[model samples]
Target: MTDKQISDIKNRIAVIAAWIVACLFFFPIFWMVLTSFKTELQAISVPPKLFFKPTLENFALIQERTDYTKFAWNSIVTSVGGTGLALIIAIPAAYAMAFNSGRWTKDILMWMLSTKMLPAVGVLMPIYLLSQKFGLLDTKGVLVIIYALINLPIIMLILFNYFREIPKEILEASRMDGTSTFNEITQIVMPLAWGGIASTALLSIVLCWNEAFWSINLTASDAGTLPALVASFSSPEGLFWAKLSAVSTLACAPIVVFGWLCQKQLVQGLTFGAVK
Candidate 1:
């Protein structure tokens, strides 16, 4: 066979492999949505039912059982708040690290990332106690702070990579033109790196939104997010598989739609530095 024929076959194999991986990753989400429409018995039947009478009863019951809007509002507030805070902090830090290098800069970055490797549960008690001592437990503000800290290293790292990819000469010209640091960032650097910033902010928000551990442990009804609401589905009696699926579906739907809508921007931001 010609070399071109071999290359074509390899490309086809890669495409098929990619499709299989995508489907595998997507299957659990598909099952959850399907199970949401089933009756509790059908959801847990000896053999999982793929085709059954779908119903809106679980969704309706979820609304009646809890304040869906309130939980959703909390989620929105915390995720956006956290992402905003992270960007405010990460931008300056990333800028310094990217442009004003020092011997320990890489070490500092590694240390920051190392914190994430520690199991969250290991420090849960100290954080919990501190929150209690400060009278900040079960508040949206506290959740926002926690989420920002949790996602900061990743945000900073992404922004740093993006910043490094930009040409230094552009900033040098601006500096020679008497541009102040604040203006340099707000006017020059930010504009040039908008794609990276947007993508970084989007990722941070998604991470914050999907955070269940802090949301469940720190917040009660007053500040509980959708994840907390999902956790509430468990009772002493037993788990309600169908209703849990229903709540999970509702919790996931908004983010999924938001992601789909902003996919172009997300892809562009993530790939901004790849070519050059």
Candidate 2:
């Protein structure tokens, strides 16, 4: 084959491989969605029935059993609230670490990153006890705080990298122009790093939304999120596979859509410095 023709063939093969990988990753979600519409018998049938009549019964059953709206609202509040708090704390911290070098800065950053490696369960007892002592258990505010702290390291690291990429001369110029640090961030740094901030926020929101352990343990009926709502499907009688699928599907839909919408930004932010 001619060289150009060979290159085109290789490109097409790569595209096909990518599509196959995408399909493999998406298969479980597709299966869950499909099963959500099937009856329990149909859902568990040997050689899974792909051509069964779909029904809304599972969804109706979920609604009757749980307050879907309340759980969803809790998820929204906690995720958004946590993300907002993380950003509020992360932006300035990242800006300082990025622009202002100090002796312990790198060590501090590494220590922050190291915290994420520690098992959350190891500290769960202390956090839970602290929360209880402070009357913060099962409160939306507590979950928001926990989520913010959990995500803070990652947010700071991401924003710090993005901020570092901005030309120092630009900030120096702003300083020469008599702009305060607050104005530098709000007016200058933020506008320039808006894309990175947005992607960081998107990531933090996703992490907060999918957090099941803390949500389940920290909150009871009052502040339970979608994950908690999904957990309600478990019973001593055994799992209701179809209804569980329905609940899982419902819980996942919003975040899935949100992630899809912001996927480009997420990719861009993650790869911000890769090219440069």
Candidate 3:
């Protein structure tokens, strides 16, 4: 065979391998969605019924008992609110770190990033106690604030990297034209980094939406998110497999849809500074 034929065969094999990996990653979600529509017996069937009659009873049951709308609203509000707050602070920090070099700048960035590696369980107590002491527990404001703070380092890192990719000469020209730092960022940096900013915001929103540990520990009712709603399905009587699956499906659907719709922007943003 010619070299071209060999290359074509290799490419086909790679494509098939990718498809298999993708299916493996997606199978659990597909099973959860499928089981949501099955009867209790069918859901737990030894053979795992992949082809069974679907039912809406699980969805109906959850609707009758839980305030799903409330949970959904909380998730939307907190995720957006947190991401917005994060961006407001992260932009300036990132810009400063990217442009202004200092002896401790790299150390500070690394320290910030290192915080993420610490177990959340280690600091959970202090955070909970402080929130309770300040009467901010179970409040949307607290959740938003905490989410932003928790996600701050990552947001700053992405923005900083994106900003660094911009040509400094452009900023010099803006400065020659008497542009102030604020205007430079607003007019120059922001426009150039728009793709990265958008992708960062989208990722932050998804993280906040999926944060079950914080949501469950911090909020009870009024400000509880969908992850908290999913947790509520568990009882001393053991798990309700069907209804639990149904609620899990509902909780994941919105973000999954959002990610799908914004996939192009996400890809563009992720690859924005990469080429340069």
lDDT of each: 0.87, 0.89, 0.87
Cα-lDDT of candidate 1? 0.87
Query: What lDDT tens digits, residue by residue, belong to model 1 across residues 40-103?
Result: 8999998789999899999898888887888999999999999999889999999989998799
User: What's the lDDT for candidate 3?
Assistant: 0.87
Query: TM-scores of all models?
Result: 0.84, 0.89, 0.86
Candidate 1: worst-modelled 10 consecutive residues by lDDT: 267-276
Query: Which is the leading candidate under lDDT?
Result: 2
**Count: clashes, candidate 3:** 0
Clash pairs, model 3 backbone: none
Query: After superposing candidate 2, which stretches have Cα over 4 Å from the reference?
Result: 1-18, 236-238, 268-276
RMSD of every prediction: 3.3, 2.5, 2.9
lDDT of 2 at 111: 95
What is candidate 2's lDDT per residue for 1-276, written digit by digit as tens?
999999999999999999999999999999999999999999889999999889999899888878788899999999999999989999999999999969988799889978888888999999999999999999899999999999998888888888988999999998998999899999999999988899888888888999999999999988999988877777742367888889899999999998889987777555533333
